[model samples]
Target: MTDPTPGRALPLEGVLVVACEQAVAAPLATRHLADLGARVIKVERTGRGDFARDYDTVVHGLSSHFVWLNRSKESVSADLKDPDQLARVRDLIAGADVFVQNFAPGAAERLGLGADDLRRDHPGLIHCSISGYGSTGPYRDAKAYDLLIQAEAGLVSVTGTEDHPAKAGIPAADIGAGMYAFSGILAALYDRERTGEGTTFEVSLFDALSEWMGFPLQYAAGSGHAPVRAGTSHPAIAPYGAFAAGDGVEVVFGIQNEREWERFCEVVLDDPGVATDERFASGSARVENRPALHGAIDAVLAGLTGDELVERLERAGVANARRRTLDEVLTHPQHEQRGRFVEVDSSAGPVRTLLPPITFDDGRTPRMGPIPDVGPGV
Candidate 1:
């Protein structure tokens, strides 16, 4: 196996990606390509560049989102409305393996950078478009921010507590769409290798997020009842939520089947009779009697410290985890031990980000490359 380090050739070392991307979704798609060693030329507005650059100044005067997504990219200033600069961007796309954009519904066509326009000129170029909704839907022209897509896709409906709906802390809609775009581009590239021709594809934030809402959607459709918002608890599963110990340390646990239920009763509760109790005999029974079940479990857990409870749960072969805050997760021991974090150079300074989740055959990570200035290609 080849060494999967910075000095060694990466999978996409020879590929070129030209991206006319501003916000999270399209930038995330191209960023993954850059992570695999593709040469990504990011085309931005002439002056202030990607508006996301102004989202915040949390990272030593740079936006954290921009720093996280724009690494290993060469940024070029462009004015699509100006013919000269538009031609420059076109020149970049002419030599690219992939061209990606997330312009509004009809903006690409107006700028002569639409998929059909580019593919007709360069038949071998893979073109991808990301938008709020799809091209043909009534909501196609509607603006779709991350939270807006989450609500429209039914994610907000199922998320958070029973009394209130909440969007995810992270940009789930943007992430879902970006991942779809990334995978779609990979599939298209593989096909192009065989056909010696490229194709065009589209990913919408609404579509991608809706696709991810599959399990809830299927459940609601089949049962004719929407899942109740259970906060930290599972809507369908029993004994699968956060519970606090005597010392107030919260631990989340789950009981999947009869065997696990029996073991949880005997090992964690120290009362095997509780398993066969009529109200808790089966998974459905336990869910129905969740109040009593929680009372019983809480009674047992209240006597033990969180660490002791976790140890006992491990011995019982129960799936469990300590409830951690975002800060705790940031400095999580597993991530640190696994060497999952790496420092990359940014316009502001060095910033740390997680390495791509996949590991190469050589058991090494990708090169953590630098973020670009507003006009690196100037």
Candidate 2:
């Protein structure tokens, strides 16, 4: 890997990561490591490479998913079943500080890339495995796609409207697993630095997303029923969702306390009496009578244009936002003003991407290296 600019080293500058990663989860973790300047060598299948590379050709004829997750890494294409190819991958990992993989449950063991075997030889190598369920659950062998894991982990149960429960537009389960793996690897690296011994850990999509479902899970266990699925709205909070203005533009806002609610009624609704009405007085009362409360809100909002309503909410000191489409988000003023977008090289061409979220106070930027094209077998 090329050296970072002198005197502006990234956090993982000297770290080396070898990743036998295919889809979203493992790729995301290694990509983050790459962002921090770790030299990530991604191992892929010989012919088609990562299957996600074919998910959709939306980004300059490159798969959007692959472009989103595989930036700043070197890819080595090899058929692991071949002795020489597998030996080459083993050699790469033998010198790596970190090794990550997300093969099918038993596939890694069959290929002799299992954590036990690798750790036995490289005692100081941090090994991470990501999977759909876990290594030893009844569902371990089950097919665990992102949507299936979302449904299984109760995320889909609490998402969308009551009549039409829906999975999140993004792959939440996969992302959750990826983030956990990323964090786990970081922690293990820290531990290795202190103790001179590496760590082996596993993260599963089902477990990761299940941890993310803490609120709804606890609510169900405590209240004896699942929270209602209210699309773009909260089940327990009032005045907390999208409302259309006279011009048909949607404005989303929320009231967090009695003070905000009173201000919202007086300024935005232009009716202070609505805040004291018995049907909508307290938080519980408003939630219980949400239909009536929304009706009253709609009546007032219908008389105001989107700009007028937003101005009123601002005057009332209530937090609010305009509902934006995907294209609008790409050019959002906040992102532009903050200089959050950057162009990176890819096989197709240069593509615009957002800078990594973590920022250094000293103005040091994360590595924004080129996306890799699959290379010939080692």
Candidate 3:
């Protein structure tokens, strides 16, 4: 079906982005630019195209990752090793407002696609480089995939249960880097508007993830102890985890302050006395006495059905959510009500995707254009 909402004067309508990217980070960055109505020309390897296209055949014969990240952009094929094809890509970037790449460390420079190399000829072009690690230090050349960066950035250390360290279910490092690169490009674009000069910036998966690991790092530094993994529970708060209702459905909630705790006790548990108990009076005390606190809360919750528990939580002003599976989330009421799903054409066929999270004051959503066919501009 044709998009019901189309052409509402997007802000980045005149911007152009040329990307030499594969996998997650760089593609994700340019995808956002494309969503905002920028023209993004994604240059992939010849014949094979982006390897992510083969990550899986889950989306109408297209890889889920490729379908997710490559929308609203044109795909071209280039053999960077070939001088003629490399020159063609260079010519494309010379006229582009933004250039993004996530080649392995030193690989861009070897291909003469490095920021410094390009900026020498196209001084007004914004160049963004995304890598596993920044272009410096011993770890610069280290193979940095999402899992490796998660481990190296100390994210895995604070994730999962204490017994078993686990990487995030999603590519957190790659997403973080992508978001930063996206913002950096926007910033560069804004600055160019004022100064009429393009700028260069770099985003590393390790650095991006390290910024996100600040909470655990600061907690460890201040207390001279690392935060322990608490499985589904909050390490610093009591009764702030998943609890099963009488129907065996899980409801996750957190108590941020004593006022909320008192409200939760009186309204949800129907026992105001639990809030005044010396052992669980304060947030710190409740955390220190988490075992007994959870036992008490679960005792009350065990008598209520999931719907009844959630209704009570809503009435009591408690922040709570149901533990939903991925499939459940696809049919989530919020998404359905907000009309978050949109369909875009792909090489395989049409596919449904979520609209971009941002909504302009004018009520115009980002234009999610089509996924391109490989070598469309070869």
lDDT of 2 at 249: 89
Candidate 1 residue-wise lDDT, 100-126, digit = tens: 999999999999999889999999999
The candidate scoring highest on TM-score is: 2
| Between candidates 2 and 3, the TM-score winner | 2
Can you give the lDDT of residue 17 in candidate 3? 92
TM-score of 1: 0.96
lDDT of 3 at 292: 94
Score candidate 3 by lDDT: 0.90
Per-model tally of clashing residue pairs: 0, 0, 0
lDDT of 2: 0.92
Model 3: lDDT of residue 44: 90
Better structure of 2 and 3 per lDDT: 2
Among the numbered candidates, top lDDT falls to 2
lDDT of 2 by residue, 78-101 (tens): 899999889999999999999999
lDDT of each candidate versus the true structure: 0.90, 0.92, 0.90
lDDT: the better of candidates 1 and 2: 2
